[model samples]
Target: IIQGYGLTESSGSVASTVGPEESKAYGSVGKLASHLQAKIVDPSTGEALGPGQRGELWVRGPLVMKGYVGDDKATAETVDSEGWLKTGDLCYFNEDGFLYIVDRLKELIKYKGYQVPPAELEHILQSHPEIADAAVIGYPDEDAGQLPMAFIVRQPGSNLTRQQVIDYVAKHVAPYKKVRRVAFVNAIPKSPAGKILRRELVQQALSMGASKL
Candidate 1:
């Protein structure tokens, strides 16, 4: 199937795979549409990044909305004065100009000074044979801004331990991106659309006390 990317603010899709040939790029959402200008910028520094560098995606085009209806404040925040609409999505482009969305910018976890994507950790966790499902969240920390915490559901009849879960993720990720905390749960909280309700998990974690887990 052809992959594409867009939002309501952009009126519709601003990029899409042309055909089966371009769709072979795997995770890419193809190239930018005509009349659309796109750029990837370092989220922290706002510096325009080159290919293979992950950053926030900005788009400018005639199709983009002038403003957010009556919300001037929201409009000013999303679309800059120069007409570049901040997509608020962490993404990167391949050398061929194909866009790959990593995750939502706001969902990123700050561990030490490094930005860790929860989706990355969740992917690794779910790959384990003992793990039936998983969701990752940023656990609050004093020294580090946030730590990667996992809420896991084990496979039927599996007897997985917290240390085993932690070790499994540590082997597959960088030191900073390691899953430092884990809690076994019956099932992961998800919305009707199957999107993980991370905010609910965060509130549950806070109520249970981080130290206890």
Candidate 2:
């Protein structure tokens, strides 16, 4: 099935692809809908990015919700003065006009100034023969800013060492993207839709004294 993208603030879909021609492009969420206007902007600088540059996505249109109920502060933060809603999603568009969602801006690991996508490392961790599932999170670190931490669920009866997991990720990714800490768990927290409950893991890490890392 072709994947489409939308949000509650937009009130409905802001982009979708239809027809056989559009469906064949793997990983694309399709093109932007005609009525809405969209732009990509650097999260830190707020400078608008051109097509093919990965950045935060912002959209504005009649369908976009005016503001969040009862919370003017949140409304102000989310919807800008120009009526654009900051989707807080990292994305990029190809030359063919197909949009691809990368990951959430809030979930990205800021390691020493480089932005590392946790999903990329998590994919490689899950590919290991002794791993069943995995999740990646950024643990607070004074020297490096934030270090990537891996929470894994091993294959039943499999015993994996911390160094083994860390080495596997280091081999696949750059130095900035390597998994620095490891935690083995039975299962990963998830929503009903099977989305990783990242916030819960963040809380877990903090409670377990992640600040020292």
Candidate 3:
């Protein structure tokens, strides 16, 4: 099976892994579709990035919508005057032009000066044998700006500790991306479609008013 990427605003698929050869790229969603022009842009600097650089994927094409109906403000923020639609997804193109989605642009954890993708940490946390599910969020911190915090659900009868979760993620990621705090939850809040309801967790964390797990 092939993977693809697009949104309702794009009028359907913008990129897809076509044949067997391109499908070999594994995690990539393939190259841009015909009549579609795409560019990777640095979200912070708005500078166009080259291949292998992780940034927001912007696309322009006939297939793209004119604007959101009755929502000019939202339309203006999403689609630029020049017609490039900011996909709001953090992605990168490989040397072969295959697109690799990292995570949602807004969901990134800002730790110190580095941008850490929470999905990366969540993936590591969920990989542990004792972990049933996991979600990562940007916890508030004065000095670090934000620290990577994990809300984890342990496997049945498992007794995983917060430090164990931290160490597991630390081993798989850089020092900046380490899980600084962990909370063992019965279940992670999620949408009906299985997307993590991170805002809820963030609010819960704030309500708790404690940094320690």
Winning candidate number (TM-score): 3
Clashes of each: 0, 0, 0
lDDT of 3 by residue, 1-213 (tens): 799999999999989999899989998898889989999999989999999999999999998998998999999999999999999999999898889999999999999999999998888887899999999999999999998999999999998898888888889888888999888889999999899999999998888777456
Global lDDT of model 1: 0.91
Candidate order by decreasing TM-score: 3, 1, 2
Per-prediction CA RMSD (Å): 1.4, 2.2, 1.3
Question: Cα RMSD (Å) between model 2 and the true structure?
Answer: 2.2
**Looking at model 3, which ten-residue stretch has the lowest summed lDDT?**
204-213
User: Candidate 1, residues 102-199: lDDT per residue as tens digits?
Assistant: 99999999999899999888888888998999999998999998989999999999999999999988899889999988888999999997999999
lDDT per residue as tens, model 2, 36-152: 999999988999988899999999999999999999999999999999999999998888888999899999999999999988898899899999999999888899898899999
- Cα error, residue 213 of model 1, in Å, equals 1.5
lDDT (C-alpha) at residue 23 in model 2: 85
TM-scores across all candidates? 0.94, 0.90, 0.95
CA shift of 40, model 2, Å = 0.4
